[model samples]
Target: MNAPLSLTTPAVSVDIAGVNLSYGTNHVLKDVNLAIEPGEFFAFLGPSGCGKTTLLRLIAGFNQADTGHVRIGGRDITDLPPWKRDVGMVFQSYALWPHMTVRRNVAFGLEERGVKRAEVERRVETALGLVGLAHLADRRPSQLSGGQQQRVAVARTVAIEPKVLLLDEPLSNLDAKMRVQVRRELRDLQQRLGLTTIFVTHDQEEANTICDRIAVMNDGIVQQVGTPMELYERPANLFVAGFLGTANILKGRIVGSGAERYFEIDGGTRFPIPEDDRIPDGAALVFRPQHATLTDQAGPQDGALSLPCIIANREFLGASIRYGARIGATEVAIDVPFQSGKYLFEIGSSGWLKLWPRSLHWLSV
Candidate 1:
């Protein structure tokens, strides 16, 4: 058995300034800029083809930017090769050598760096121990479970003690239950190491639960950057409002004048705009499913706009019931808590959707 290793590595800040990358005229990345703080668990979140992976690869020196620089710990390493850049990347596939034992795989990176044989063995053992896979050091990748293989891949990267850790959809290959279990483990591991880590994923729940902050990308552009709650509560635009979660967006026109201005939607719903709220031209009315309540009364109350709608469909979620309400030609979803004896609205039932003004967000497409 090897001695336990101490991994008290200092954290480093990663800064990307005016970074732009393009494959011919494809323009993969726009004028992107970001500042990732030291020891921060940040996430690059978006749908596929959104440049999240490209940006992550750029940081690891796998992909070069057409213009701009990537600085780590106040040092510009834009021209550095992959081996020269002290950044460890865990790919989505969890690349492992099938024939090699777990300990040998973990030691591969250290060996390639010309580390002393004894030190390499010690670090490999320590890395395996850190991930709680020390007992399986002699097992080949083919004999381990998916989660164990992922831990081995992580161990391989951390054995080198990279300044920044890059994980590109690292949990994508696992089952749903395993994804949840492994994400928590990964978060725990990152916090213990105090490493500046960046995770890339398209799943909102994964990004929301594991990351401190997220940069949401779309169409090769960064749409917004903030905490999950911040982005969900205060989305910058319609795309952001729809992407982060289930948002009910309705096209409307601002009518009246001055303090008596009203937002009129096609569904014959007119909502008074508070003086403090600024409604930009061409903006749409957006709200979460739980923000509106189904009511029998047509008169609006509780500082909410009452819109007449018909229950179109219903879906039984575990703890909540989601109803599809049709307002004019537009369809919006409304969520109601499930209870043993609560009254349930049947499909085609007519009711009013009372929307609270404070919970509404005005966003543009």
Candidate 2:
């Protein structure tokens, strides 16, 4: 039997530089540049029609870039065809042939390449075992559940021992519970095999859960690329701030600048701004839902920005409560920890909103 490919040497790295793509007149990807580390689980995250899938296809050699270059393992493969690239792709549709048994589907790639019959059988068995489908090899795709069919698709991709694995929203079609279960299994399998993998998803939760690092894209441009924590805490711009989580934006003018920046809201309410040199004389203030608090206490404390507001609505979200309040003409959303001891205010209840100055982020006007 042929032994499994060992990744003792450094695994292959994928790189793209100044990549651009267009279908006739409509530009899809615009001057995109990214690097995927060897044996790392990297994710491309964005909404629909945001060029995330197009970028994946470029890496897999299914679509060529209109400009720039694509390199694998430090070798330029811009002109290489799909078959010669040695990349495994798992699509969202499961793409399994209904006529072929699970074993034949898993061995399809090797069979087409004219691999020996004995080696194909051995590799197919090994791949099926890896995905926990060894006993069901004789069953057709129609006989398996959605989750099982997805696993078969994964097994088929891995059977060829490709240099890189590309997954394009492979779990999107499954039910919610099945998606969670299969995602855990897929992540475990990828880590155990030490395969260089690139995952594309429109679901932020999925990317945050499985990816070692993620690149957030929008409108044919990459907005930010970092670890989950980095993207959540220090987003590069307004789009990322609103995209990753809920953000409360406030308009204000810079009253003071330099080390001790401060701003005044519409009600002449003064608040200290976080130390950011980029914020000019006029800018907007942005903060997360958790950063603002609805407290009974009045007056300003050290490092706190106070605002007068009336509770407009309250929503129950399991362990936390989302409170919507109106401050003058602006509405603010605040997420507070659920507790029995805390005072539960009714609608139209007037109170003071306290926010930490350090938690506030400045945005250009």
Off by over 4 Å in 2: 1-10, 256-270, 274-282
lDDT of 2 at 62: 85
For residues 6-116, what per-residue lDDT tens digits would candidate 2 score against the true structure? 433456898999999999998999999999899899999999999999999998888889999998889888899999887899998989999999999999988999989
Cα misplacement distance, residue 251 of candidate 1 (Å): 0.6
State residue 11's C-alpha deviation in candidate 2, in Å. 2.1
Q: Model 1: per-residue lDDT, tens digit, 253-279?
A: 888887889878786767678878877
Q: Which stretches of candidate 1 lie over 4 Å from their true place?
A: 1-9
TM-scores for all candidates?
0.97, 0.93
Highest-scoring model, TM-score: 1
Please give the TM-score that candidate 2 achieves against the real structure.
0.93
For candidate 1, list the clashing residue pairs, or say none: none
